[model samples]
Target chain A: MKRILLTLAVAGVLSSCGNNDTSKQAADQTETAHNATEHEEHGDHDGHGDHVASSVSGNTSVNGPVRKSDQASAILDGYLAMKDALASDNSAKAAASGEMMVKAFASFDRASLDPKQQASYDDTVDDAREHAEHIGTNSGKIDHQREHFDVLSKDMTDLIAVVGSDRTLYQDYCPMYNNKKGANWLSTSKEIKNPYMGSKMSTCGSMKTEIVPQ
Target chain B: MRWLKIAAVATVVVLVGIQWIPTPLNRGDTRADKDFIALYAPPARTGTLLKTACYDCHSNHTDYPWYSRFQPVAMFLGNHIEEGKKDLNLSEFGDYSPRRQRSKLKAMSSQIEDGAMPLTSYRLIHWNANLSKADEKAVLGWLKSEIK
Candidate 1:
């Protein structure tokens, strides 16, 4: 009878702990939703210099120095240009942007990165350059270009994860692409202008996460 | 003792009854023209390894074990294969654009090198699905040659 009572006491404690965990998880989710709303508000307030300045300073307080590199910024700019071209369904412009990105990647200063970052960047760039070249050569084949762009977006995401970004970027995902395997792309704006679907389904995706400068 | 006997019989009856609930099978009658093996034409050993390790999920045809016909397990395996094929249907490799093909090849090589394929959960049951050290070398070497 005493042993039975002990087991009941232990069970009560374990169940209570489980309840606490679930409540904590619920609170964390609410906090995350609050932060997402704040990010949306920040997007609306973009280009307002005072707002931008205050947010940058606020972020700096949480994170360390903002990672800034002219070469990385140039590569990011070229990538964004290509994204915009694809979103606009302009194959030739996308090809030109792809060529520009290949050059940007070629001239990227690796000396600025640490050894681990350099290794990851090198692996990513090799595949990225191949994708860019495919896009650059297949100017008229928009479908083929979109396929390449789909994979190239992954490489860009990987590159940014290692090299860091100069400005805030949004990672958007389209669930209907590639036979429902889904695909993701980075954008400078919060708006969903899906490059994968172009005008057919321009607003098909939603922002999954925001990458702020750190 | 009577209650224990009744409970045991009830469990057995429930188990047998559940087996009648059918699950969708991934087996296909014919090989696709764009099949990965047909397109790439890897060596015999590499081909066999891929079939054993990947085709069970990533291709249209799965070599179902006899036990896989049972309940709950069948549903679980069906869901797994569906998710896997969505990510990569190797049977339709030839249908992908050249750039997408290149990207997929690169991903395959990296996944193999990282020991992330033939997923750990899968290897636990399908003993032959585990890629040995030499298997990894052969697969990666073949993938590298094809990535270009």
Candidate 2:
């Protein structure tokens, strides 16, 4: 009986170690979901940046990355898909996703946006659309497509800065890209799996910052 | 003591076995026009100094040392080059935007002055990689004059 108990104890310890890693991964996913839901519910408000309503009084953590409309969310889905395709180094898939992004950008009616956000949205969408088209058109030329992706990422960053994203995002950077010129992209995961360098330098970057919705 | 002998033998065997495993070599012939010296045009002497001290880790091509032929050492050197190039790649420096070029030059200068670069650990193996105080000062001076 003692030997059986000892064996069980060892098994339990080993299993617990496995559970620890799973729990950490689960926590990260849960945080992303929690932030997404929070954005969806609170997204209707026009307060972005410094003027965010302090739900209570002194709590300013609710400041923002608030993409307040369905149009914005749809565009993000396409952008995320493109990001994943690039991460996988699938040029054709990336090009397809880029086309989807252009459609999403076009589908968004600027008139539907809150009057306060209209000017920024109009400014951001046109630039983002142009880059998306470039990325989509260059299906065979992956390197050139990636360059456009980098520029698209910058526009996306600017867009998110103004309106904010409903989903959690991380702004990642690879310093070695563009001949060590450095480039930025948005990622769903905080981990620095670079999309720019593809397989040769897949893990060659770091999270510059996070863009969780307020 | 008996267990220690067994452990030592096991370690030696593992070490020898690992030596046969090949690591990826970061050696490629990239064109000169794309290289940092050619792109930004740092002074001729300074460019040479940068190559001697920095290129092995911070460029696409690594000038591997004799020790790099061994397994564990090869892996270590490969990992270092991967990490180093992520932060700075001299071979692609010219391709950077003008703004990015200035930013990197500024960062390099600061890192040099702070003694946070050309990592001390690297200098231990390749003593020639060590930049003297005067050389460091001169590099920093050149950066100030040229970069800004």
Alpha-carbon deviation at A103 in model 2, angstroms? 22
Indicate the worst ten consecutive residues by lDDT in candidate 1 chain B.
B94-103
The sequence of per-residue lDDT tens digits that candidate 2 reaches over residues B5-100 is 999999999999998887988976566887887776777778878988889998888888888889888898888999888667888877655545
* Native contacts conserved, per model: 0.15, 0.00
lDDT per model vs. reference: 0.71, 0.66
Question: Which number leads on DockQ?
Answer: 1
- Candidate 2 CAPRI classification by DockQ: incorrect
Worst 10 residues of 2 chain A by lDDT: A1-10
Candidate 1 lDDT, B44-118, residue by residue in tens: 999999999999999889999898999878988999999888657898887665545777886677567767688
Instruction: Give Cα distance to truth, residue A150, candidate 2, Å.
Output: 22
- Report the lDDT tens digits of candidate 1 across residue range A18-135: 2447774454344433443454454422111112223433431122322444557878888898899888899999999889988988888888898987877787787788788778
The best candidate in terms of lDDT: 1
